[model samples]
Every structure is written in structure tokens, then in C-alpha cells.
Target: MVRPVTPASAGFRARGALVAVAALVLLAGCSADGEADAGASASPSSSVSAAPSSRPDPDAPLDANQACAAMYVDGGKTLEERIGTALVGASDGLDGTSADQMHAMAMELGRLEPRVPEEFQGPLEKIRVPFLQLQEALDLADGGQVELDIASTVAGLKEYEKLC
Candidate 1:
């Protein structure tokens, strides 16, 4: 004959099953190299460095204004993030990664400059001076100068964003 389970015993069994499942899930995430495997991949839309080709063509006649705005908006967040990282990295210490990030941002801004609309050209141009200054500071490992340039770049970008 089978014995009747008490309420306490039933609750304990249910908790045991849950704990076992949790352990299996945790273990499944571990790789043989002792690194945890990435479980979920991000979609392209969630990526920061999305392709510029997906944006409208700057030279295209029909929608030049919209194209310019789209181009700027597309890369804005990623550039801002890199700039912030560079600033923080400088403040904390002249970390290699931080300087590298700032360099990358300068390159990206240079690439995007030609796409600026005539109407927005002045503001984008304003940004270049500080951007170059920031890069120079990074190269010389001048944290104080880097901090000042980062602030200037951020302010210019804010105005640029307002245009779009």
C-alpha cells in the first residue's frame, strides 16, 4: 500500500524539484573552459554600431535633409557612449582602452562629418575642434585637457542632436 503524503512533505518535494531545475540551468550555462556561455544573442536593432549603409544617402537629391538627420541619429548614441567611456577612463587613469575608444570616436566623427546637412554644417563643424582637442589630449595623456574637451564635444553634440 502507498502512504498518503502530508502537506509539508508535498511542499518540500515541489521546492526540491525547483531547486534541481535551477541548478541544471546554471550548470548548462558553464562552458568546458570555465566561462559562462552567452545564452541569448542580441538582434541587429539592439546593436550600437549599426551599419551606416542602412541610413539614407547623404548625396541623394530627393531626401537630403532627412538623410542627414538619419545619418546623425543612427550613430549618435554609439559616439556618445564612446566619448563618455573615454572621459571616465581618463579620470580614473590613463587606461589604454580609454584612449583607444576616444581615437575610435574621432575616426567615426570624421567619417560622418561630410554627411552633415548644409543647414546643420556649422554646428557639426563646431564639434570638430573639441573632438580633435580631445584626441590630442588622449595622445599626450593629458587627463585635465581631455576632461575639458569631452565637455565641449558633449555640448556641441547636444545642439547637433536638437537639429535632428
Candidate 2:
């Protein structure tokens, strides 16, 4: 015996199909490594290669002009802007956005600390210390420590800016 499909049953089957498709789409984006694969049209650096190295000597000290250029090439300005914005926002209130920014900036600096020019790494590290403390203060709502750490971070940044 053959049973005719009713409109209601057809609609329910269509909805179930749509849900399965959506689930597959979402699962396709998930990765065990927690990193998404960039599209094929992404920037060149996103791909790995075995090209010869042309980077300058990491131990060599750069002149002010070179130092500034290197900083920009290494995304220093972007880091500073993000960290500064986080500091300012955290100063107003210790909210999730501010805290996330601070944590992200701190982790970024930790990764970049070793990559900076040898001469600037020390001062760069000094600035990172206060960033850590600022994150902690924000988490704890310790306004007094936050103010002091902010001052210290500003001072460290000024020193680093001189190298730039």
C-alpha cells in the first residue's frame, strides 16, 4: 500500500532537511586545531613556502628610521592602538570588552616580544609588564593598582617611542 504525503508532512520534511544542511555547514567550519583555513585568495604569507631567507640580522641594532619602519612592519602601531584603547576603556569600567582587549593585547605582546629588534625588546618587555598588571587590576577591580600600572605603561611606551 502506498501512502500519499500530506502538505504538513512535506513541510516538516523540508524543515528537517534544512536543519541537517545547516548542521553540516556549521560542522564543516569546525577544526580540531581551533584555526580556520584561510581562503585560497588570502594573502601570500598565509601560505607556507621554502623560499630563501632575506630578513636582516636579528641581533643587529637598527637606526631610528629603520627601527620605526621595522615596528610598523611588525604591526607595532596596531598593537599600541589596541592596547591603548583597552587601557582607556578599562579605566572607565572593567567590562568584558575591556578585559578581552587587555588579555588579547597581552598575549599578542608575549608572542611578539621575541620578534622585536634586539635593542627594543627590553623596553617592549617593560611595557608588557604593566599590561599584565592592568589586566589583573581590571579583573580584580583594583582601581589604585590600575592607575599606577597605567602610568608605568605610559612611561614605558614613551621610551619605546623614542626608539621609533
What C-alpha lDDT do the candidate models reach, one value each? 0.42, 0.48
Ten consecutive residues with minimal summed lDDT in candidate 2? 1-10
Per-candidate clash tally: 0, 0
Q: Top model by lDDT, which number?
A: 2
Please tell me which predicted candidate would have the highest TM-score against the true structure: 2
> Candidate 1, TM-score vs. the true structure?
0.46
Query: How good is model 2 by TM-score?
Result: 0.49
Model 1 over residues 31-127: C-alpha lDDT tens digits?
Answer: 2112211111222335447675676444554233332333332343434444444444434433456456656666766766666566555555655
Positional deviation of residue 56's Cα in model 1 after best superposition, in angstroms:
7.3
